[model samples]
Target chain A: MSAAVPSMPGTRRFALLRHGRLLTGAILTGALVAVALLSLLWTPEVPTRLRILAKLKPPLSEGLLGTDQLGRDILSLLMVGTANSLSIAVAAVVLGAATGTLIGIVAAMRRGALDALLMRMMDAVFAFPPILSAMMLSALLGSGRLNATVAIGLFTVPVFARLARADTKRILRRDYILAARGAGKNAARIAVDHVLPNIAGAILVQVTIQLGLAILTESGLGFLGLSISPPAPSLGRMLADAQTYLTLAPWMALAPGITIALIVAGFNLLGDGLRDRLDVRRDVSA
Target chain B: MSPLLDIRGLSKRHPPRGFGRGAGVLALDDISLTVEAGSIHGLVGESGSGKSTLARIVMGFDRPDSGTVLLGGVDVQSASGEALTKVRRQMQMVFQDPGGSLDPRQRIWKTVAEPMGLLEPRLARLQRREKVDALLASVGLQPADGDRFPHEFSGGQRQRIAIARALSTNASLIIADEPTSALDLIVQAQVLNLLMDLQETRGLAILFISHDLAVVAALADTVSILHRGRIVETGRTGEVFARPQSAVTAALLEQDAVSLASTDQLKEKIHYPR
Candidate 1:
């Protein structure tokens, strides 16, 4: 029960280390989002308008990044593609994390038969990989951004469920939780007031990491021609289109490819940094 | 007048783990005790003596196999939903670990006001804050101390915060399970004195559970000595301490005497840095 007072100097140094990673990740992630938002206002040329005369122009030509096989500006396509990819990733992560966390909390609180059932069902969902599930849904629902989002989001349900369930179970065992119950607080009230607030740090770290994974999943589906149909300028679809013209136009493939990698890295770094900062026990030991 | 808290013929057995067919270990054996209004009934025993099991049952946290717990003559064991909650609000617990009892992430005021928030959901936030401040003051803590977290306080301060929380509901009965076992000797004395003061001022009935015979002897009026899920002896604290009938009670009193003598010697030799 004795509270361990962490040394201020040690904690301040650790904070600096964690902040370094967070800052880098934030900057990279911010720049990509800014590009995507800016694309909503203006791009060098219309992303889908094909000018046959300027086909396959290299970098620093008619547009900043050049033109694609159809003469649609590569820079414009990259920007618009980022917006599409980001929107899908954000929606999928939000949907998956929110629903999954709710299920997890319920499962942990109503432990025993209900807990076993919910967890087993989540295991069933976990069996299917994100891209495979997205492809199957795309086949049934037909290829579109909405279908892609649902598939990727559903795929992430088990991840959040497992994390949320474990964290909730741990919090449920804490003395304060028992005290809360003893104070006449019901299960639902305790779940909201006590359980959720304590586990939120872990859940947030999971969400950031999942955002990166969702983006990757959507892009993989698009690469396989099962996500966000052609002419709308998705990052994955652009990569797929560039496959045939790789030798003739490498930038067509490289532009979207590098952008996807940077964004994913950004999210991952941010998640790691957050996990370190928020969990004081881990922070002190490390 | 009926006792403020009454427990009768309560028995609980944990179901055998795994796929076994045998009966489980009996945690409590028809345990019965009562706390009269404005008095302290101490349940003293060694570890695994069913002290905590009885406490949990009295709080309605665990269901008893055979007995009924009556709070103000209401059968708490039979109550459900809102009825259970209503009965629960009349009785609260002060847990063993003071530091762990209060939420580390929450401010002292929020932790103190949590019970009131649950029981009186319609109370204004400002009003609740004022009430929490008053509760802190009652527990010998400054009103401004409510703004800090549990980690910012010493072990004794955290226990005071917990005592404030227990009093938040204006509960008639407070079940304190070894409330000061975790503190240093000086802090332990302070917390015990505070509990005694609160009991006198609030007319609060207390079920004080502990393994330490000396501490319980000092605070509790009536003492029940439990051994291996059964009450070995029960009587007024002074009579039992002076003339222990059961071997378990005699051994506990002897051990406590030895520990007290040794602690006195140690205290003289050791000076703890403040």
Candidate 2:
């Protein structure tokens, strides 16, 4: 057999071309992040303050992007709304992915009764939609962004658990894991050193997709009056508030609606791109 | 001296499916073998002949229904936690598929040095790298090649990396389960020669399990022929090869002759470097 050779120059170039969609997704996600970060320090007008005379003013009039039904600045609300939605989505995704992946790894490592129990628990969670759970949680815990985040995060646990469990099981079957076991590495070491790294790519892709779902769920809860209370700007609440003034102030609904769509689309594209790049089988074939 | 690995009256049966109405199939039946330190004990058997089952039981990966596995004088089945880890540190295994044996995502250095990290745990990163380089060199792989991933190397090179990993802990006994079965005939010989060199230098006891009798004939000192979970014959390599005892042995020898002849023809067609 021949000595080790470096990967082909063409292969590197092909990888870049293959992940072009990832670059586009990153750009989209980055722009939204920038808007959210920009909102933290400054906005043209106060999001919550009312100016009665400027109610339902057209875009570029009394305030940029005009005023809403409460005569609150649409531009400011949209900026702050972006921040709120992004933060909640990030928190939920982190919470769900971390806990769910741990559960999944445990299930995969200890098969039989534990595996069945964890999966059944996930199935039970799967029975109720995220929105339904969020509504129940909102009623029980009192309506706010924290409760909404917790509810949505809990909903994503089962998804992450199933994905992590399947990926871990596949990795456990590899001979390297057997070799590690033979090498005197215990279950925890095997999981951390071997199983986790191999399955991280799959989990990462799932995380991005779950972020999109979390954002969507958060907005749905807000629209239904089960999310963050009024006076604080929320994209979904803004959409709900603007529904009555469809003719007089269509921009009110248009701004938040378009923002939610863009954020979700960005995350979905990013997730798809990550799946393509992280697919080990594709790398093996290449 | 006591054997490096000793199995006595080892038997394992898989439970029958469908509410366990029927009797379970015996994977290994009353099997017993011993590998002396610094000697190679070849376990030869065809597929479904329990060679792998024997390897797994000896490695403590699976428990036997009835028998004891003593590795380096420690009972493998009875040991637990830190004791089991200590016992395992004295033994390592080379799997059948070299490609699947090493993690594709890990660099050669990390893969080679993994056992050392697990067993010793206190070795500094630099020291581990030095040991990894030395291990790679011992396996005839360039020290610089340790930076590359497993996929970047040829099958033989990967197998060498696997060997390097197995040798990391400086184990007294190595269970090589068909280690050379995946490579070309010429490469297979090179790997076998490498194993022999390691065995001689380190005085390693090797349990070489393989389906090919010809391959075992080259390296094994004491040979055990298995058929359908039972040992058909056990003797010195020369005696087993020279004599005709069991029908299973005769059939296996005849099969090896046919395959060896075909291999010789193939070796001639393609000019392989010695």
The residue-level lDDT of candidate 1 at A35 comes to 94
lDDT to native, each model: 0.86, 0.87
Which candidate comes out best when scored by lDDT? 2
TM-score of each: 0.92, 0.92
What is the C-alpha lDDT profile of model 1 across B1-274, one tens digit per residue? 8888888888999799889778988989988888899999989999998888888888888888998999988898888777777787889999988867887778889899888854787999889999988999998999999888788888898899999999998988999998988888778877877888888889898999999876776778999999888888999987998899999998888888966455444434333111
Q: What is the CAPRI rating of model 1's predicted complex?
A: acceptable
Q: What's the C-alpha lDDT at position B50 in model 2?
A: 89
As for model 1, its CA RMSD to the true structure in angstroms is: 4.7
Indicate the worst ten consecutive residues by lDDT in candidate 2 chain B: B265-274
Q: Give the Cα error of residue B188 in candidate 1, in Å.
A: 1.5
Model 1 chain B weakest 10-residue run by lDDT: B265-274
TM-score of chain A of each: 0.92, 0.92
TM-score of each model's chain B: 0.92, 0.92
